[model samples]
Target: MDRDEAEIVALLRESVRQQRMWLMVVVGGAVVAGVAAVVLLPGARLGAPLALAGVGVFLGVLITAPQRKLLAQLGLSRERAIELLSRADIAGRTPEQLRERQAQRRTMWRVVTAVTTVIAVIAIGYVVSQAGNRVDDNVPGSGPTALFGWALFASAVAGITAIVGFVQLSTFASLDRAMSAEGDEIAS
Candidate 1:
């Protein structure tokens, strides 16, 4: 195969691998958060910031490595990837069409973000409103305050991941199909 097609194949492989990694991050983060909520279950005031910062940092690490790999494999930086894919997309021919396609692709994630926002608002509200429940140290999960705080935390992590992953999935996950070149095309 030609260099370009070979590079595309490498990109396809990397994309699949990175998608799986993010999927694992989502599922695994859920499990970890569930356990932490049950075990430590920090109070509302404490959990909110910790959860936000902790999850944010975790996802940052999860996202950073793949770029290096993508660059190494396809010699394509993130901007180049976006540019190539956008150029190849039919709707990308016009500004309006490109915006429409972007909106269509982002619709699911936008819904997810909205739902998660509502959940977080409600969770933080309930947790804060039950401000006195933190001292119920005798029983586990009895503190609705802490439970909701942890729930919000977990939701925040998963929500951010979903939004980012969905966008990346819509773009990068389709690499093979997007840049596919077969037999004579590759040879040429």
Candidate 2:
């Protein structure tokens, strides 16, 4: 109803939009690379990890670079965070408030990380178990299938690491952008 509420909505919407863009980039890149690798390198055995990991790194850079640029343009300095909160519906938060917010965020990240780790472990176990079956059964060129299985496992790990790494590094990325802006200001 108020101007502050409208600003909050706009900021939140922009945040969601950015997240969607990042996801689309990551998912689209991954799918295309995966299909291309499988098609172009059939029986190559190493295609999965190579293609997926490369895509992961590329997507990470693409997302982070734009995020950093946006943070700089938004002037997301510590002072600005405090300033924005000052009129947004309540008085500005104190240092303790900021610390509490960070602690809560860290807790949330820990929970998510723990869950993802469990899933990854289960996935790795499944892949390894399946790979072992070839050896147990002593099938010829089981070698290639086993190798391909490992490649799939590695690809999964790489993709998971990329997404989680992006989430964890976000704060530092914003800080770096803010600091860069400050340095530019000082120089000019």
Question: Considering every candidate listed, which one attains the maximal TM-score?
Answer: 1
Model 2: residues with Cα > 4 Å off, grouped in runs: 1-12, 47-55, 78-122, 130-140, 146-188
Segments in model 1 whose C-alpha atoms lie over 4 Å from true places: 9-17, 36-63, 91-103, 132-146, 152-188
Please, what are the lDDT tens digits per residue for candidate 1 over residues 1-188?
Answer: 23674456456556757777887878688678767766774553454567766886887667766766766766666776666554455532654555466566656666775676666567667656766555567987675644665666656665576566556556733643444443237659
Q: Count the backbone clashes (under 3 Å) in each candidate.
A: 0, 0
Deviation of model 1 at 121, angstroms? 2.6
Top candidate by lDDT: 1
Error of 2 at 100 (Å): 20
Supply candidate 2's per-residue lDDT for 85: 49
**TM per candidate:** 0.50, 0.44
Query: For residues 42-111, what per-residue lDDT tens digits would candidate 2 score against the true structure?
Result: 6665544577568678777766665456446565654554455455523466645655665676667666
